[model samples]
Target: MLFYRAALPLSRKTLTFVAGIIRRHRASIGSCWRKLNPGQQALLVLAHLRKGETLAELAAGFGVGVTTAWRYVNETVALLAARAPKLRRAVRDAKKAGYAYVVVDGTLIPIDRVAADRPFYSGKHKKHGMNLQVIASPGGDILWVSGALPGSVHDKKAEWIWGVLAELEAAGLVTLADKGYLGSTYAKIPYRGKNKPESQKQANKAHAKLRAPAERANAQLKNWRILRKLRCCPWRAGQLAKAIHVLQIREA
Candidate 1:
């Protein structure tokens, strides 16, 4: 097959940063030589995550075996994921950033069917995917991204299970979210029930105005193509999300 050149819309700083991580990881592991150097390995992983390149295509382009390509992608993803901020740290960061509030939201990262398929199916989305909880600043900056849970988990349950509510309560930050988070202990969600007083309706209108930025945050995360859908194992979804989270923070 003929090899062709391609482009990724990433800045040089992002590429250099990824290469640095690979360099340090190799030093820590005392790794031997590989089919690709740290820069090449970083490129391979970034291409896979950013462009959703297939394993066969990546392997062929990089001049390595498919297994080697897979290994590199997984290794680099784990390295980046380890750097993603945890929830508590994220909230403290928002406080330091002088933001009045943070926004909590969740999204479905669609995935291919696995052997144990039942749990990954979401009745709401009518598909198989992973649930990713994202916490963002008022300015729509991503502060944290939680590990993957099965798609079947409701948005409310997913947040609760991840201790989002408890953490926000402890932090005492004003948190904005959609109706999916209505029952949260600390987050402020829109009003429900068919018959609402004029004041509740006005409250929802104002709430929606404030929460528009959160939708942008979700779009930003999905901007990384690999997250659109996962052809890899379902278990890898969390690592993939976290990896992208780190990359996005670097990008922003």
Candidate 2:
């Protein structure tokens, strides 16, 4: 009843990560995602985010239509979100097993007018609408992802650190983030004991150092042409994150 499991040549890191996830959220994965073909589901999800594919493009690529492609993307995203508790637990376990020190940030995806009209964003992109806010580990594994918000919405305005920190706290892990997340309240240990200006500067320095790995991780993600382009809708972005995470874990 394995809904999704990686194929052979599984890297030690990937096998460990998957095993941890399965151990932590055995119930949810079995209950919800058991019906779907893990390979097709993973491919379909990745196709949406991969560069050079519109809904129409995806339809043609998968030999379907725009409508059907959209349906699959939505359904898959909904399924993942529904099983968020399990995913969260998996991420928590990974952190506990020395994968702590997460990198938190957000990205935007552009959408056309028809999709733009939906409530996905509070505000719209200049011409294309956007899906905002994704928090991932250094290996590109998503810790938590927020609902699609307006492109105009600033990362700071979203205040995702609190929730992300809470999850980390519950998991007993520490966090590392960029300046965008400064002043954010989460499961963080702030640096102390420097003079006023120096203290602030030192905090910034520390954050930068801690965030270095995640920055590199994001760069690696961008190296994948798929993530470079905003082909998928917001929902598909989550799926894309999952696929990338899987790939990263395997490579690791």
- Candidates' TM-scores? 0.95, 0.55
Task: Give me the overall lDDT of model 1.
Answer: 0.87
Q: Write the per-residue lDDT of candidate 1 for residues 1-55, one digit (tens) a residue.
A: 9988899989888889999999999999899988799999999989999999998
lDDT per residue, candidate 2, 68-90, as tens digits?
67766665545444545343765
For candidate 1, report its TM-score.
0.95
Which 10 consecutive positions of candidate 2 have the poorest summed lDDT?
A: 1-10
> lDDT of all the models against the reference?
0.87, 0.53
Evaluate residue 31 in candidate 1 and report its C-alpha lDDT on the 0 to 100 scale. Answer: 93
Q: Which residue ranges in model 2 land beyond 4 Å of their true spot?
A: 1-45, 55-91, 112-131, 138-141, 160-162, 170-172, 186-203, 216-252
